[model samples]
Target chain A: MKKTALLIIAVLGILLLRAAEDLPFWGDPQSPASVHLSDYYLEESYEETSVPNIVTSVLADYRGYDTMFETVVIFCAGITVLIVLRRTHRRRAKVISPRPERPGADIILQTAARLLVPMMQLFALYVVAHGHHSPGGGFQGGVILGSSLILLALSYDIQMALHRFKEKLVLLFSAGGVLLYAAIGLACLFLGRNFLAYGAWAALLGISEPEAHSHGMLGVEIGVAITVLCIMFSLYIDLASGGDLDEGL
Target chain B: MEDLLAYIISRYNYWAAIILLLIGLYGMIAKNNLLKKVIGMTIFQAAIILFYVSIGDKRGATIPILAHGHDGAHQAVEAAAYANPLPHVLMLTAIVVGVSTLGVALAILQKIYRVHGTIEEDEILETIDQ
Candidate 1:
């Protein structure tokens, strides 16, 4: 009864709040939002840094400082996952598998995995590569890749999936991605520019003028995508591994 | 009045996203079950993604591609007509962040479940006290 009353009151409060705000509920053709962010990119962004892909420009150049921290956060997660999932050499015997197989899950799963895994992996690669031009990108592509493994785990047993690809590799890849990003930043520092400065790389790589910025940004975007993908995989392993119970260390 | 209704109907995605977000928040605050909390978290994250996608919308814009026209030069279009890729870019990062945080929370919840054997917040508290 109290829950019902609270729910009603909450609904009323929400409605009142919506009524009070004069926010545009629909897409207004004349609104400030209709302007393509590209205009800002073409005019201001190019002058500041000459990257062609504005998203990459913003991520790698304009806001690379934030991105450094974002990379660090992902690294923190990878470390945490490692810490939580780490198994001591002797304690490997105590690591219990979650579910015991009943009957013919093996034959059925083998047939399905044979057909599905290749197609999913191909799609993920397409998403990663075509990200600069389309609605998809490294993060989305990475999740798709990570979730494909999840599809495997649900269909097959966890032991089979773990055997196919170790979590240690995923953690290593994730850490490597972050290290690559920092290395780029450090490289920029060596070249006498700010951390993650693309201009410095352009000069070092002998990339001239406008194209230099584009290539530099692309490199960083690759870094971002890799980190995002590995982090997503790490997250999946953490969640789907039944809370890392009995994994010593 | 008819036009007003049409406008509202046309942009139902944003409305739905906002509604979902509110509903998720309400559930998060009101529900006592840890499972329900996770459900709310998913709902909220998905709603936020919807909101971000809506922000990327431009009425008649195509994907911002620098494809060549018949002349083999970059086809120029009105700047106002291109979708804002910034929101999508930011949202992509946010989605990954959301998943990671949820993974950590769910991991901790598993530990809690193991220790207490009940997923209800109130029940756990009661058990702890006793």
Candidate 2:
């Protein structure tokens, strides 16, 4: 079976290589992928949305609907994991041995986490907020924020992390983030524009259309960050504790 | 021979991505341990992401972020001066979705281990047959 699998993979790889012969050379500026729509996004994204970061503008503004659904997909995955693994009552024999208890929380680790978590969170916020002008953005920022909590869980215990950020609150934040994104879209709708049309917000916010686009993108990015942050930490605690919400790795 | 070598060198990034993809496919297909399979899936995802980001690259271009003057003057944005942003934006979604899928897969694996008392695919299959 293993040999057959290897043979199939070899054939597949060869076919892929054959197909690559027709593709554009690496980093060709005139490649089809670089020309068709990408050129438009690069040339006009700044003037259209006032976001210097073309990727951010394209992701959160030009493709707002796609991003909204992407957030929903993440939210659904988190909830699926919770439903699949979470055990409310322990009736059956434990399949895995409980993690051995450490004597106590290591002072050095706790102290370092204490010092690092705040800095990490602050940096994450900066990444989310400064995404328009720089490299950082909602998803990257949210992952950073999530990792800070994971680091706290790793240094101390899952219970401690959960105590600080309760499971209920995590779920709430995850849902709330998606709601916030949709609410912005709905607000645009009620203001006499299509769903997710940031230009409609200009009248209400007393800003130019481009500035409204920028603010709308920022608002949705924050929503994405909030959902991602909560869902990431929630996934860690659930998986680390084998869905019991008890002690974790 | 010289022409062939030049061609290969120019397309090395795609070659690398394909090689990584095959390795991932092999692991996913042949590994008996469920956890190893999950790791393989992750590698597969990383390979695809790399391939996409590669497509967005330009030989003599900066990143997609527009450059502004120190005095806040807007210059004419040239399409050739910056790498493509579309693929990067799409891959951002791919990456977040990948992580979410990994979480769900790991959770399901944990549940499987709990029920079957093993994570080996063969062992689980045998138990199911019995």
Q: How well is each residue in A33-66 modelled by candidate 1, as lDDT tens digits?
A: 5455446753455445543345656666677777
List candidate 1 stretches off by more than 4 Å.
A1-16, A19-21, A33-38, A42-53, A82-103, A243-249, B10-14, B68-72, B75-77
Candidate that scores best on DockQ: 2
List TM-scores of chain B, every candidate.
0.84, 0.92
lDDT of 1 at A16: 47
Please, what are the lDDT tens digits per residue for candidate 1 over residues B18-129? 6787777767777888888888888988988987677666667666443333342344445655566577567756766776777667767766766687789889999999
Global CA lDDT computed for model 1? 0.65
Off by over 4 Å in 2: A89-103, B1-5, B70-72
Model 2 chain A: which ten-residue window has the lowest total lDDT?
A89-98
Candidate-wise lDDT, in order? 0.65, 0.92
